[model samples]
Target: MEPTNEDYTYRAGDIVYVFYRNPHTQDVANIQEAAVVNNPENPNELAVFLYETYYPLTNEMAVYSTEEEAEQAYHHYFGGI
Candidate 1:
């Protein structure tokens, strides 16, 4: 998923991770993980926009290609998500 801030650590083409919600329970039980990859065929805006748009309900703290990096960034901002 995309980071809320424009100047974020993650970028297009990165394997963004998002902990999506369980629609049924509305809880943080489900994971809406996805890769925010940029497709050359589409516009840059459209490519990046999909990441966040797809998982709007996710309590996404941070996004990175690697799990290790993701955790660090996630907690750094959210303190613990």
Candidate 2:
């Protein structure tokens, strides 16, 4: 039930939360898909090409199992109606 990398589309100005598996941590970041390099040498992956809101940080993008979970996290971190 986990969201696959293909499920999410990187958009400019889209706020995202990344989750690292090794240490198990969450990071809020912004999407800069436009600046991402998609080439043979530099393979383009959604999780790897993201702009971290907090510098000097390393965490892979979290994949929520459902849209509700993602929305809840987004609301909790960014506030919502």
lDDT of each: 0.47, 0.37
Which residue segments of model 1 deviate by more than 4 Å?
A: 1-9, 38-42, 46-65, 69-81
lDDT of 1 by residue, 1-81 (tens): 443433454556555555444567773433335755454454333133333453221223434455666566656755765
Model 2: lDDT of residue 36: 20
Summed backbone clashes in each candidate are 0, 1
Residue clash pairs of candidate 2:
19-62
Q: For residues 1-81, what per-residue lDDT tens digits would candidate 2 score against the true structure?
A: 222343555432334444332234444432122222233232333223333322221124454434466667656766741
Q: Which candidate number maximizes TM-score?
A: 1
Q: List clashing residue pairs in candidate 1.
A: none
Superposition error at 50 for model 2 (Å): 12
lDDT of 1 at 73: 61
Worst 10 residues of 1 by lDDT: 54-63
